[model samples]
Target chain A: MFRKYRKKSPWILHYNAGSCNGCDIEILAALAPKYDLERFGVINTGNPKQSDIFLVTGPVTFRSRERLVELYTQMPEPKVVIALGSCTCTGGVFRDMYNVEDGIDRYIPVDVYVPGCAASPELLIDGVVKALEILEEKTKAIEKPFRLFKEASSENGIINRRHSALKVGEKDEED
Target chain B: MSKKTIHIPLGSQHISLLEPVRFKFECENEKIVGVDSDVGFVHRGIERACTTKFKFDAIGYVVARVCGLCAITHSLSYTVAIEKLLGGEISKKAKYLRILLLELDRIHSHMLCLSHTCENAGFEAMFMRIMGDRELVMEIQELLTGNRIQFDYISIGGVNRDLDVQTAKKIIENLALVKAKVFSYIDEFTNNWSLSLKFKGIGALTLEDAYRFNAIGPLARACGLPIDVRNEIEYLPFDEVGFKMQTHNDGDINARNMVRLNEILNSLEMCENILRGLPEGEIFTKLKGKPKGEALMRFEAPRGELMYYVKGDGSAMLNRVRIKTPTFACIPAFSHIFMGEEYADAPAILASFDPCLSCTAK
Candidate 1:
């Protein structure tokens, strides 16, 4: 029952990794009164540590990939990642771009893939709700001292690990 | 608040704008002190790719995508440039049809600018009203060219489609109604005391400033400088299809809007005149010989003068192609105009130029 309450309210953090702003606007529109993703309890939170989900847009540019990994790792464990837009899922139209490395999944593991030059707001809200369902299943398994475990780990070490992981991730993908 | 300079970077990607361009804003206490802009983001090397990648006949289709709002204009200009280079002339009727389509595009571009500007201002109702009225122009464009926005009508030698009698009659009726409705909107916008306050003194660029910065289109026209390439370099049917040039002495956001609005009205008149005097002949003059050597061409787009320099190298494939869009000419003017304005007006001020970063970047 307690896990159900936690599952109902998942915090999301928004990231832009060098897009044309089409997806960014759609993201904003998804949060607006018209779409109202808030009804699904998918709230936008400022701090990454508190975030249960990460919503990333754009085709991870060469410079932004490092920052994106840092941000993704800062979120607590049992976190879900939603790669929003075709740019994030597979680099979309910006694929094979000179400066852009590839998609968001090149740096971080994505839980849900929302595709479109920009996925519509309604579709985005649906993807967020689906991510919350995944988080609930994990919450029930690790019930003991969950809040304590989250507080114990320092954000800095998580960031360093992410950087190293990204380096290894890139090499592995290239190989 | 202390007078401290804060450097805030905007764009490369922006919330309210489309097209990728970087803007570095130097702000002092929430007021913009200076704006530095860079528009070279999506440079596809289309001009370079065009000559080498695309054949001369097919280059018109590629150039049409250079700017979605002025697709037909770019295609027309490219075709005309090639036509002149080949010493080939289009039918008198084809020339008038080109003018009619071009005027419709002008209406499409101007109404879109006004509607989008209103949208940025949070006036959704006014935006929709302008957009709804703009459908008439789109309908005419579609009727003539079979596409709403990207009209793939202009071929190398002439137009691909002809204006039927019913379509031409509908265009005349639609244009008159659109003009009247646009004038009513203009009247409301001009008389709305608050809109005047928001626009009159904002984003001011003097005539000398515009000339020095090489501002083009309504940006220069707003400052009472009659520097239209159409007038400077004459085209067929321009003298016969009489239309008045609109100018304003004050180079503010309002002046720019007024110039665009007035220009749309004149374009409608030009369209009507072209239809009345459209002559009869074969549409295309056949290209028998290969285009050899290099040639440069320029045409006045709805935005301003567009230049295309082509080097053929005596082969079917072109050696080089360079294009200079109107927004490229106005980048310096934007940097100058953006200085010493409140940060809140940044989006509004930027949109006033009707800047197409897509064209600038390409």
Candidate 2:
């Protein structure tokens, strides 16, 4: 139902996972007039369940790891996660810092990685736009109907649960 | 009969909060009675990293990562402290370039705080307006330093880039635009009835409370306490570049917003003066020495006073790098201000304090 509109309107859920505020501000600037990510019908939502794109900044910290995962899980399926900035990608300058994990991908799957010390607003706008394409693919994958190509068995076309009876095109020796 | 107080918690993550900071407020009716904040969420163990992983020369950039908003200040203070230990004199042109970047940083940082404060108050248009105008400063920053957010502009003996004629023209043009927008904001903040009502008497901090709690930056300045690191530090020629202390006595959100607005104007004027008096000298000076002693450097970050303490043990690896960020210092005062105010106003009040948790956590 949302296929056509989904690509046009991708709601964003932004979370700061222990970043230096560089990427976070850039994300806001992207939403601002000059770069204007909002022109693509993108709305920054606080609710994870309603969001289709999760824009996460900073290298995941010990304390924020749980929040990062929780936010990711809370976001509905067929979602795109964009890691903004080098720190969020591979910990950047903060790679060796004790409390920081290498990047957010250590805790969750990231589809788009935009790297910079603090990624520029222009780059952030580009990242979000790229996320829209990923979001479209995930949405298509989720909504695509599954089809059965062939029969499973000769007798009843029913697959057996037991491992010994689970032969595809041949009966088990005991059978 | 005894009255029961209700507890309302706002973030380690919340809609109004941009970063992870959790505060539990115990409220008696609509008034907040107690506050407990947890600001360690953004801590990256940067101090430990400084002493062990990075060399003295490279720590300037590492420390800059502490907070993006005040990155320039962090690097400048760290570089200044290192220079003090090295005991070398950089060119006057280099100092001017450093000041130029510092003032530009302050302008953007204060504008961010003001815009954030507007956002938290549910003034969407005002927030967008301020944010849209902020790009003017950001454009200049990018032109001068080649990056918007993390401009690793300031280096040990000098700056990373020099200002060229084209960039200088861009800086002057954009700063004028920012200055114009700032005036309109000032008029809106001072005259708008709804904004005045929401901000005027809400979350008020008296001069006595400000002093007792040791508030710094715009927070203290708004309360009429003249505690500005810019005035105290002689390392940079702040006085030569027309640095003025902006203060307001009311100590409410409105007062703090006014202070920020006025400071932005002052910073714009300084940037103009710096560009106008473009001196001829080298931007970087090569100083040959290993840092051996301890040095404490303090500068006025946009949020407040940023202090960097560096103890180098003559080796490439230093002993300790402690950053006393303004947000960390103002936590006590932040909690104090939350008391006796409506729980609804918490976000606006919090934004007005301009807390930088990354800086604090680092």
Whole-model lDDT per candidate? 0.74, 0.88
DockQ of each: 0.07, 0.77
Chain A vs. true chain A, TM-score per model, equals 0.77, 0.85
Off by over 4 Å in 1: A1-175
**lDDT (10s digit) by residue, model 1, range B113-154:** 776676665566776677667767766876887765557888
Model 2, residue A53: distance off in Å is 0.8
TM-score of chain A of 2: 0.85
Could you say which candidate leads in DockQ? 2
lDDT, candidate 2, B12-47, per-residue tens: 778788899999999998899999989899988999
- Global Cα RMSD, each model: 8.6, 3.4
Per-residue lDDT tens digits for candidate 1, residues A1-175, read 6566567778777776655444554564455454667777776665678888888876776656766788888888878899887767987554565666678887888899987654666678878888887787667656643221112334755533323343321333332
Least accurate 10 contiguous residues by lDDT in model 1 chain B: B12-21
